[model samples]
Target: MRSTFSSRLRRHALLGFLAIDMLGLVALVVDQVFSTDPVYPWIIAMGLVIAALPLLAQAVDYVLSTPADAAIVPDTGEKIP
Candidate 1:
């Protein structure tokens, strides 16, 4: 696949995951406000997964897409031999 295509797909996937995380956050808040002791742990667990999915996706995408020998972010200030 072309780099542009892959990058755009990654961007959209991350955005989708982020939306899920945000919704999970809302769920957590709503649950907290309404109920007392039953759903909090479950909501928190789901929230953690939702929050981590995007970051995990990003790391996987970067590792799979990038060359193993290449630096993740190049040093822009100066280069020394």
Candidate 2:
């Protein structure tokens, strides 16, 4: 159950980032071609930053939630029987 939720969060966060990046790109082009205002780019940047916040928080939580020792890969350098 826990893993499912964790995976879901990661999936959603990545999707959100992808969406924000694509939208920002589109907005930049639109602003350059159709709009004269420069604020649109700033607005897109702010949206990206805001969208990143939850992803950052969730990433930190995901890292911290795991056991410290688990982060280290075991040495497969020498196999001891």
Candidate 3:
């Protein structure tokens, strides 16, 4: 199946968040090892918040796409007995 632009955007956003989180972690480690006054802990926290944006976007998308009265069905083809 071909992916839509929104899906691509979401994926890219998630990847960007991951990159930022990784950079923040590396900076935190470097700061702790070298500096007496640390500042990158806030960067880590900001990274966490940034990571959550993709999740929040996903949740909003799910809520918006699903119909209010939609039936719940398992992906497995097995019928309920």
Cα lDDT tens digits, model 1, 1-81, are 698897878777776666676666666776777776756756775666676776766765675565676765567785645
Q: What is the C-alpha lDDT profile of model 2 across 1-81, one tens digit per residue? A: 998998878767765666566667767876877686787766766676676766665765675465667636555775544
Q: How many backbone clashes are present in model 1?
A: 0
For candidate 3, write residues 1-81 as lDDT tens digits: 355777767666766666566667766776777664566665665666566766755754664464665465545786865
Error of 1 at 68 (Å): 27
Model 1 earns a TM-score of 0.43
Clashing pairs in 1: none
Q: Give the TM-score of candidate 3.
A: 0.42
RMSD of 1: 9.2
What are the root-mean-square deviations of the candidates from the true structure over C-alphas?
9.2, 9.5, 10.3
User: Per-prediction count of colliding residue pairs?
Assistant: 0, 0, 0
lDDT of 1 at 55: 74
Which one wins by lDDT: 1 or 3?
1
Model 1: CA > 4 A from native? 36-81
Measured by lDDT, the strongest candidate is 2
Residue 76's lDDT in candidate 2: 70
